[model samples]
Target: MKVLIIKTSSLGDIIHANSIISDLRRNHADAEIHWLVEESFSSLLNLFPIQKTIVSKFRSWKKNLFKKNSYSEFFQLKHLINKENYDFVIDLQGLIRTGIMCRSLNSFGFNKNSIKESFASYFYKNTIGVEKKIHAINRNRLLVAKSMNYEIDQNNISFSYNFKKDQTDPNSIVFISGTSNDQKKWPLEYWIKLAGLFERNNYKIFLPWGSVKEYEECLTIYDQTTNCEILEKMNIDQLAKKIASTRFAIGVDTGLTHLASSLDIPTIGIYTFSNPDLTGVKNTKTPAFNMGSLSNIPLPEEIFIKFNDLA
Candidate 1:
C-alpha cells in the first residue's frame, strides 16, 4: 500500500502527528509511507522510518504568494504528489491550506466538529470524528486507526526514532528555556533555581536557544547558574542529536521538549499558560511529566522533587 501523510508546520504539532507512523508501519508492513512536512521541519522526518520526505515551503510561499516563484513551487509540488498516485492520503493537519493540498487526492481528515477549521472538512472525501479534548498524540492515532479500520493497542503505541547515541552524558540535563510565546515561559528566576538544584546534585545543565532573544535569556540563566552552559545555535537535526545524548530534559511548552519525549527521554514539560490535558509531553516508553497549568506555575523545588523520583 502507498500512503501519503500530510502534516506541515510547527514543531510540536508535527511531533504529535508523528506518533501515528509507528501505528501505520505495524498495521501495514508493506506500506510505502511518505510524509509531507514544512521545509524547515523536513529534517525531523529523517529521524523516523519514512520512505519519502516531501518538502513544502508554505511559510515562505505564503509570504511570496503573489510572486511567480511561489506559484512555480506550488505547481511543482502538485505535480510531484499527483505523480505518486498514493492509495491513502491523510491530512493530519486539519487546516484550510492543508485541506486544499488534499483536494486532488482520495484523502481523509478530521470532521467539521473535530477540527478547529470546520471549512477544511469539505475537501476530504472521508472525515473521521475524533475527540478534540484528548491529547494531541492520541487524537492523531485515533484518526488514523478509525480511518484505516484497525484497533490501537493503546498500551503499545510507540514514538520510536532512528537515533543512535554517540556519547551520552548520563549526568547531563537539557533545559529547554525557549518558547514562541512569552506567556508560556516559566520565570527566569525559577529556571536559575532549578539549575542550581541540579548543579548541587552534580548534573550539568545544557541550555539551547533558537532566536537572539532566547539566546540572551539562556545567557542570563547560564550566568546565574555555575553549572549551566548555553549550547551553540543548531538546526532541528543537530539539536535532536544533541538532545538524544542527554540524561534528562526539563523544558517549557516548546517543540524541543516534545522532541526529547519523542526520543524516549525522561522529560518534564513546564506549562504556565497552556493546558497540559490538550498538548503535553506524553509517551508510554519514557517518564513524561507535565507540570503546572495556566496561571499556576510550578515551584522549582517541586520540579526538583519530581526529577529525583524519576532519576
Candidate 2:
C-alpha cells in the first residue's frame, strides 16, 4: 500500500506525529509510507524510517499568494503529489491548507479540536473523532489507528528513529532555552541557578540557540556558568544528533523538548504558560517530566528535584 501523510510545520506537532508513523508501520509492515513536510522542517524526516518524503514551502508560499513563482511552485507540488496516486493520505496537521489539498486526494484526519479549524474536518473522507484534552501524540496515534482499523496500545506508545546514539560527554546535559514565544521562556535567572547546581556536581551544560535574541541569552548563561558551552548555530539534523547523544535535557515549551522526548532522552519539559496535561512530554522509553502550567510557575528548587530524580 502507498500511504501519504501530510503533517507540515510546527516542530512540536511534527514530533507528536512520530507515534502515528510507528503505529502505521507496525500495522502495515509492507506499506510504503511517504511524509509531506514543510521545507524548513524536512530535516526531521531524516531520522524517521519512512519510504519517501515530499517537501513543500507552504509557509513561505502562503505569503506570496499570487506571484508567478509561487503559483509555479504550488502546481509543481500538486503535480508531484498526484504522480504518486497514494492509497491513503492522512492529514495530521488539520488545517485549511491541508484540507484543500485533500480535494484532489482521498485523505483521513482527526476530528475537530480546540484550536483546529472546524471546517478542516469536512474535507476528510474518513475522520477519527478524539477527545480534545488528550495529549497531542495520543490524538495523532488514535487517528491513524482508527483509520487503519487497528487497536492502539495507549501505554505502548513509541517513536521509531534510525539515528544511532553518538558518543557525548558523560557529565553533559543539553539546556534548551529557545522558544518561539517569549512568554513560554523559563527565566534566565532560574536557568543560571539550575546551571550552578549542575556545575557543583561537575557536569557540563550545552546551550543551543536559534534566534539572535536567544543566542544573546545563551551567551549570558554561558558567561555566568563555570562549565557551560554555547553551541554553534546548527540545523535540525545537527540539533537532533546532539539531543540524541546528550545525557539529559531540560527545556521550556519548545519543539526541541519534544524532539528530545521522542529520541528517548531523559527530558524535562518546563511549562510556564502552556498546559502540561495536553502537551507534556510523554516518553515511555525514557524518564520524562513536565513541570508547571498556565499561571503556575515552577520554582528553581522544584525543577532541581525533578532533574535530580531523572539523573
Q: Superposing all C-alpha atoms, what RMSD in Å does each candidate have to the true structure?
A: 1.2, 1.4
TM-score of each: 0.97, 0.96
* Weakest lDDT window of 10 consecutive positions for candidate 1: 154-163
- How accurate locally is residue 16 in candidate 1, as Cα lDDT from 0 to 100? 88
Instruction: List, residue by residue over 1-311, the lDDT tens digit for candidate 2.
Output: 99888889798889989888778878899889999999999987998899999998888888998888988898788788878998888888888777767655777887665336978888878777888888988888877787778999888879888878888667889999999898899899999999998888899889998889999999899888888998899998789998788899999989999999899889999999888888899889889899988788888788888988887
Best by lDDT: 1
- Displacement of the residue 71 alpha carbon in candidate 1, Å: 2.5
Q: How close is candidate 1 to the true structure, as a TM-score?
A: 0.97
Write down the lDDT of every candidate, Cα atoms only.
0.90, 0.86
* Model 1 C-alpha lDDT per residue in residues 1-311, reported as the tens digit of each score: 89999999799998988889889878888989899999999988888888899999889989998999998988889788889999988999998878888887889999999998999999998999998898889989988888788889755657857768668799999999899899999999999999989888899999999999999999999888899889999989899999999999999988999999998889999999988988999988889999999867999999999999997
- Model 1, residue 121: C-alpha shift (Å): 1.1
> How many angstroms is residue 218 displaced in model 2 relative to the true structure, after the best TM-score fit?
0.1
